[model samples]
Target chain A: MSYCVNCGVELEQSLGQCPLCNTPVINPREAVCNKSPFPEEKGQVEVVKRKDMSILLTTVMVSTSIVCGLLNVLVYSSRPWSLAVIGACILLWVILIPIAIYTRLSVYTSVLLDGLGTVIYLYMLTFLSESSQWFWGIGMPIAVLVTLVTEFLVVCFQMLPRSFLTNTLYSFTSLAALNIGMEILIDRYLQGTVQLGWSTIVLTVCIIVNITIITLLSRKRLRNAVRKRLHF
Target chain B: MAKREKPIPRKDWYQLDLSAIVYPTLHRHDFAPVYRQSVLLTEVVDPELLQRAVDLTMPRFPTYKVAMRKGLFWRYLEPNDRPGPFVQPDIKNPCQPMYFKGNNRYLIRFYYYRNRISLEAHHSLGDGTGCMCVLQTVTAVYLRLKGYPVETAFSKEQGYFVMNIDKQPDPEELEDAYMKYANAKFCPPRPGEKTYRIRGTKESFYTLNIIDGIMSTSAVLAVAKGYHATITEYLNAVLLYALLKKQESDRRLRLKPVKVAMPVNLRRFFPSKTLRNFITMIYPGVDPRLGEYTFEEIVTQVHNDMRYHINEKFLRGDITTNAATKRHPLIRIVTLFIKDFVIKLFYTRVQDHNSSAGLTNMGALKVPESMKPYIVRFDIYMGQPFSSRTNCAIISYEDTLTINFASSIIEADVERYFFRKLVQDGIHVKIESNREMTLEV
Candidate 1:
C-alpha cells in the first residue's frame, strides 16, 4: 500500500525498501515482518582453485631435481652434469610460479622475474662452459628484449578498450618489434654492428597489416563488415 | 504376496535436440541455460504433499527426468533413475548452475517457499513452455494432494489444461520436434549483427538479481493496443527504448543497434506436443546510430520487425540452418572434445553478442476451472545469460501479468526504465524483488 517516494512506484508488502531506488519504505500505517519472496541464503558456486595443480607441479619439479642430484653425486661425481637439469628445473619453476603457485603476483613483476631467472641460469652455464661472454653479450639482452615486449603487450591489452582489431594491432606490432630487436642484439653480439636481414621482411609485412587495421578502424562501414564476417 | 509388475519398455537414451545441443557445451559452474516457472498459491505450500505431487507427475514428463551424459561424438541424455531433485526449501538464487554429478543426476529442480512452488529446468531439457507445463501439472497434483478436487480427465472434445496424471506419456511428448520439422535443404543464412550490450558492474558471485513488476494484464494489453502492437512487440520496444535512453544518459557517442531478443515458442506454429527444447530467438531493434527514436517509432519498428520474422517460413529457416550444421559430415565425425570447443567458441563469440537483452513471453496460462481458484499468479524467470546484463520473462494468469527481470549486474537502471515506462503509460506496477536494494554503480 506504500509507494516509493522517489521512484513513484508501488512497493511490495514484503520489501522494506524500494527496489529501484534505495529509499527506505517508512509506511507508518503498515508493519513489515520477516516475509520475503526469496529466501535468505544465497547459494554460490565453488571457485576452482589452482592449489592442487600447484602442488602436483611442485612435487614433479622437486622430485626430478632430487633424483638428478642424487645420481650426479653417487654415479657421475666428476662432471656434475646434474646442474644443467637443476638449472632447467629452476627456469621452469620461475615461469610456472606466477601461473600456478602465486597467481596474485602482477604480470609485469612475473615477466621481469622470469627474465632475471633466465639470465641467472645462463650465468650458471658459464661455470660449465669455457667462456662467460655469451651470457652477457647475447643471452641477457635477448631475454630482456623479449620480456619488455611481453610486458608492453600485456599493459596495452589491459588498458585499451578490447576488440578484435585492437588486439590484433597490439600483437602484430609487438611481434615486429621483438623480431627486429632480437636480430639487432644477435648482430651486435657477433658482428660488432647491427644488421637486419630476415627481420626486415617481417617488419614490412607487419607495417602493411598495421596500416590496413588502422584504415578499418577509421571507417565505420568496413569495421562493421569485418566484425560480421569474423563473427564465429 | 504382491504380484510382480511388468516393466514398461521406454527409451533410456536420447540425442539432444537441435536447440539443446549448444547448451551442454556452453554451460559452466556459474552459468547455464536454466529457465524457472513458479506459481504463487493462496495458501502456504506443504513440502510432503508437494514431494508426492512431483513423484506422481514424473511419469508424465519422461524427457525431463534424465541427466546429461557425454557420448563419444556428442553429449546425450540418459535416464537419471535417481530420487531427486528432492523438493527442498527454496534458495534466494533460483536457476543457479546445475551439475550432472550432483542433484541426483536430475536436470530439473523443485523448490517451495512461502506460497510459491517453483520449477527450474535446464534448457537442454526444455524451454519455457515445457517448464510451464511441468509446473502446472505439479501444482494441480499438489492441490489434489492437499484435498482440493482438481480435474485430471483427458478428453478430445475438451482438451485438458492440466495433463491427465494417470495416462502414460504420449510418444509425441518426448519427440525432438526440430528433426521432424526441419528441412535441411532449405537452410538460410544466419541472422544477427553485433548489437549494443548493456554495461555495468556485474555481481561478483554471479547471483541473479530478480525484480518482478506485477501489473494488470488487461491494462498492459490496452496500452499495447493503443500502440497497435501486440504485448510481446510492445515489451520488446520498451526494453530497446530503455537501453537507448541508458546509452544516451551514459553519453555513449558511438551507438549500435539496441536490440531485444525474443525467444519464439515453436509449438505455437507447429502441431508439436513436445516438452523438449523447441524455440528460436528473433531480434527486433532500432539502430540509434541512425537517429533518436520516439516511443511510437520504436513500437512500430518492433511490431513490423517481429511480425515479419515470427512467421512459419522465417522460423523454419532457423530450424533448418541449425539442423544442417549439426548434420554436416565434419561436425559428426569430430570427437566430443573438439565439438565442445568449437560450439563453445561459437556460442560465446556469435550467439551471446547478437542481442543486448532478451524478453520471452510464456503467454497466457490456462488451468481447469476447478484448479484456478487456489492459484494466485504465475511468474516465469529467464536465467541470467552469460554476457547480457538483463533478461525478462513474462507470463499472465487471469488478470495479473508478471514481468520478471533477471539481471546479473549491480545497477537497476534497465528495470527501472522499463517499469517506469509502463507506470507512466497508466498501467499500475507493483514492484517486488528478492533482495534489498543497497548496491549502486
Candidate 2:
C-alpha cells in the first residue's frame, strides 16, 4: 500500500490522492485509480423555469389593458381613461421584456432601460392630457434628473471601494445630493427660482457625516476603535 | 385471479414535539430541514426486497409514516395511508425539499443507489439517530428477506447504537423528552459571539457538492492523542484553523472569533431514547480579538469548552430554557400563522446568526455481528446549512471515518485547508468528491 507523504499515514489502494491534504499521489507502482463510491451519473438540480412566470405576467398586463380599453369604448363612451391603462401596460412591458428575454442583463443596461421607460410613459401621459408645454418644462426635467441621479448612485456604489460603514455613508450622501438636485429642479421649473429649503439642511448634515466617516476611515486607529465598538 | 383487498384502518395522529415545531414552520423552497443516512453494502440493492423491508419496518417505527399537518394553534402530525414513495433509483440531489408542490404523503423517503440504500428524513419526523435506527431496521429486514440468514433478535427498547426491530416499538420512543425533562429554573442563554463566516460564489443551480474524506480512525485518534484532545475537539480546531486561513487571505471578513457549532447528541446525557429532534448546539472557538492563537491553544480551548458545556446539568439547563420559551402560556394561545411568522423571524435573525457552520459527529454505526461483513461503510449527510453554504457531518464504522463536507458553494478552500492540515498532523485521508478535477474550486 502506498502511504501519503504529507500525513505519513497509509493510503488506501483506491484513493487517487491524500484525502486529508488532497496531495496528488506520485507513486509509479500504485497508479491505478479505484472506482468511486459515488454514482457515475452526476446529480442534476431541477431549476424552476422563469419562462412560464414571464408569460403569465405578460398575459395579465396585456389582458388588463385590453379589457379596460374595450370597456371605456363600449360602456362609458366618455373620456379615454383607457389611455392611462394602456400607457401603464406599455411601461410594464418595457421594464419586464428585457429581463424576461435576457435573464443575465448587466445592471447598467437594466437601469438605462428603466429610466427610458419611465420617461416615455410620462411623455405618453403628457400627450394624452393635450398639454405638451409642461412636459418639456417640468415632467421631462424631473424624470431626467431622477434617472441621471439614480444611474450615478448605482454606478458609484458598484464601482467604488466599499466597506460597511463607507457604503452606508455613500448611500446617505447620494440620497442627500439627489434630494438637493430635485428640489432645485422643482423650484426652477415651478417658481422660476433656484431656492433651497429643507434640502439644504439635509445636505449639510449628510456632508458633515460623510466627512466624519472619511476622517475616521483614513486613520487606522480610529477606524479600528469604531469597528470594535460597533461590532459590524 | 383476484387481488386481495386489505381494509383501511383508522389513522393515528400525534402532536409535534417542541423541537420539531420549528421545522414545519420554517420549511421553505430553499431551506429543507432534511438529513440523510445511508449504508453501503457489498451487493447491489434489490428494490423489491427493499420495498418489502420498508413495509415491514414502518409498523415498527410509527412516527416515520406520518405527515405534517397545520393546526389552529400548532402544527401536528397525522398518520398518512398513502404508500411510502417506492424505492426508486437514486437521482437528483441528496436532500431536495420533502414537501413537494402537491405531495406531502410522508416526511421520509427511501432510495437505492448501486450498492447504497439511503433514507432521507425530515427533521420533524426524527433526528439523525432515529433515522439511522430506521435505516438499520430496513437493512436488516432486507437482508433477512434476501435469504442472508441474518439474526433477527432485535430488541423493542430504544438504546444507543442498538437496532430495535422485530418487536413492538416502545411508547417512550415518541415522548417529547425536552418537555418531559424541562425544569424551568430560568437558565441564562449562552454567550452570543459572531463568527467569521466563509463566503464564496454559491452554486448557480443551488446544488450541494459533497466531498467524503475517508480516513483511518486509528490514525486520526492517534493524532488527537498527540494534541491531548478528543477527536471532536481536534477536528473542531482544524475547522477553525481553516476558517482563519481563509480570513487571512480575504481581508473583507470581520476579525471575529472563528467558531464551529458542535451539535451535542442528548442521548448521551439523558436517559430518553426518543428519536425525534433532541440534540442541542454548543459554539466552541478561539476569539481572534485576543490576538493570534496557536493550534495547540485553539485545541485546548475547544477541549475545555466541550468538557465544560457537555455536562448533564448544563445541557439540562439549556434544553429547559428552550422548552420553557415554547411552553409559555401566551405563546400557546397565538394563532398558527402568527406563531409561524414569529418563529421564522426569530430563526433567521437570532438563531441563524449564532453560528458560522455546524459540525455534527454522528459517532459510530453498530450492527449485528451477522450483518457486519455484508456492510461496507456508513455515511451521514446533513442538509445544506441554514445560512452558510457549507456544513460538515461525520460517521465512522469499523476503522473508516467518513467525513462528509456538504456545500452549496463552489469553493473547496475550507475542505482543502482542513484536510491538508490533518495530513500535516500525520493523518492519512483518502479524498473523494463529486466535483470533476478540472473544475476544482
Candidate 3:
C-alpha cells in the first residue's frame, strides 16, 4: 500500500494520491518512493467501547459469599447453636432482600438492610435475657471501631502510592488523628474536664513520624522527577 | 545634504582577551569575542570596482552612513587617527590589521582578506535585515570592480545614526523624589566602563555549528503572502518550533514560555538613527502548552508580538524618557547610566526565562548575487554569547536557508534534539563540524 508523502496515510486503490491527507502517493514497490514505516492515519474509524467488562464480575462475587458462609457454619462451628444460627441467618437474609431491592439509594438501601438484620438479631437477644448494659458500651464501641477500620483502610488503599509500609504509616497516622479528635469530644461531653493521657501522646508521635516519612519519600520522588518536570 | 554630524565616541560594553581560549570554528557554543573564526571567499576585484558595489548596496541601505549619537545611551562613533576594526596592524595580532584597538582593549576584527569584500556584521551591530543592505551595497562595489554587470545604483539609505547634536534625556519623574534624592546606595557602571578581565580567560568558548542558506526572494515573499508578515516571521517560526520540541519533555514546568528575542529597528520606531544599539530587543513569548502549532500560527504570533513592542505607545518617549536636570550633568549622567545599564540586565533575564534560545531574523540580504562569483553561503553570529545561555540564528541567502544553533548550555541534548527535530521537519540542516567545517585558522 502506498502513502501520502507530506502527511503519511495509506492511499486508496491505484490512485496517484492519498484521499485522506491529499498528498501525492508513491507506491512502495517503486525504486524512487520514500516512505516511513508507520503512516499517520488521520480521521480513520476505530472501535471505542463504552463498557468492557460486565458478566464476569457477577458470578465471582456470588460464589465467594456462599462458600465463606457455608464453610463457617458447617465445618468450622465448635458450639451447639448451629441450627439456631443458620435459621436466624436465613430469616435475616429473607427480611433484608426486599429492602435492598426497593430502596432508591445504594448506600441507604444497604444501610437499611443491615438495620433490618440488626433488629432481628436484637429481638433474638431479648429472648436470651442477657445483661443490656454491656451491649450499650462494649459492643457498640467495638462495632464502631471495626467499621471505621474497614473504611479507613479502603481509602488509604486507594489514595497512597503502592508501597506497603507507606500505606500502613498513612493509615496509622490517619486513624490516630481521627481518634485524638474523638477523645477530645468524649472528654468534653462525658467528664467535663480537659485531660491528656499516654495513648494520646503515642498517637501524636505516630502522626509526626508518618508525616516525616511521607515528606522524605515525596522529596525523593520530586528530585528524581525534576528533569521531567522543570522546564528551566 | 543632511545636517553635518560629528564622530561621537562609542563606548565598549564588554572586554575580551583571546589568548586564554580559542575554538576553531564559528560553530562552537562558547562566547569568543576576541578570536572569532571567519571564512573569506575573496573575489580578487580592484578597489575602484568594489567601490561601485558599495554604491549599489547603499541605496538599499543608505541608513548606515549616519553618525549615531544616542542621547540616552551616549554611545557614538568618534573621529580618530585610525580606522575602526578595519585597520590592519603589523606583527603580533594578524587580525589587528583588520581590527582597530586603541586605549581601550576593545578591538574589532573585520574581513577583507583578499581585495574587496563585504563584512558580515555581527548581531551586536544590528539584526540581519539591518546589516543586509550594508553588505549588499559593499558586495555591489566588489562586483563592479571585478567588471561584473553589477548595478551602479547609488543607495539613498540614510544609515541609522544620530549626528553632532546636543541631545539630552528628559527629566525623570520618580515619586520618592526627595526621600532618596540626597542618598542612593548603589553606583551604576560608568559609560565606556569595561568589565574586569575574565580573570585569565574568564570564559571558555566553543562553537558547535555555523551555517548559511539562501532562499528565492519569491519563496520568502510566499511565506508572507496572505498574512502580510515579513520573511523574518517565517524563519523565526522554524527556530521557535525547534526549541519548543526540545523543551516539551520537561514535566516540572507547569508550562514553558517560548520566546523569540527580536531586535526592532528604532529608526522606524523613532525618527532617530544616529545611535549605536538603536535597536531594542523585544521578546515575543508563547506558552508551548497551547500545543500543535502550525508554522503559519507561530508566524502570526511573532508578527503581532513584535508589532506591539514597536508600536507608538512605547516609542512616544514615555517609558524611556528621563527628567534629569541639564545643569547637573552628574545627575543626568548617573540617571542615564542607571536607565541604560541597569534595565538591560533585567531585560536579558526576562528574555532568558521566556525563551529557549533566541532567533534573530535580520530579513533578506540584498547583495547583487553576481559579486561573490556564485555566492557559496551567508552567515551571521551575535559576535558573543550570553554569560551562560545559548542562542540560534537563521540566515537565508538564495535558495538555501541556513539555521545556526549556538549554546553555552550544559544540556547538549537541547541543541541535539532541536537539530534532529528540525531536520525531521523537512529543513535541510547542515551542522558545521570540527573537521568538516572549513573556517579561517
Best by TM-score: 1
Native contacts present in candidate 3, fraction: 0.00
Off by over 4 Å in 3: A1-232, B1-77, B83-107, B112-134, B144-203, B206-208, B211-230, B250-254, B268-275, B289-300, B303-354, B368-377, B397-400, B409-441
Compose the digit string of candidate 2's lDDT tens values, residues B317-360. Answer: 88888887787899999999999999999888777767777899
RMSD of each: 5.7, 6.2, 27.6
Candidate order by lDDT, highest to lowest?
A: 1, 2, 3
Residue B32's lDDT within candidate 2 is 81
Candidate 2 chain A: 10-residue stretch with minimal lDDT: A40-49
lDDT per residue (tens digit) for residues B302-354 in model 1: 98998789898889888888888888998899999998898898888888888
Candidate number that wins on DockQ, 2 or 3: 2
For candidate 1, give the DockQ. Answer: 0.34
Higher-scoring candidate on DockQ, 1 or 3? 1
Each model's lDDT comes to 0.85, 0.78, 0.42
How many clashes show up per model? 0, 3, 65
lDDT of 3 by residue, B1-441 (tens): 134344333323221111000111121222223222222344443544444444333322322322222345243332232322242211111111112122221222234434324343322233344344345545544544555675533323533111111122111110112121212233322112111111012222232222223235455456456456776765566566655655555444555566666655544644432322344456665566777677668878877876765674553332133212222466446644564554455434442344445566544444443443535555554433444444566555456555444443333334444444444444443333111111211
RMSD of 2: 6.2
Error of 2 at B393 (Å): 3.4
Which of 2 and 3 is the better model by TM-score? 2
Every candidate's DockQ is: 0.34, 0.15, 0.01
Q: Predictions ranked by DockQ, top down?
A: 1, 2, 3
Fraction of true contacts retained by every candidate, in order, equals 0.61, 0.18, 0.00
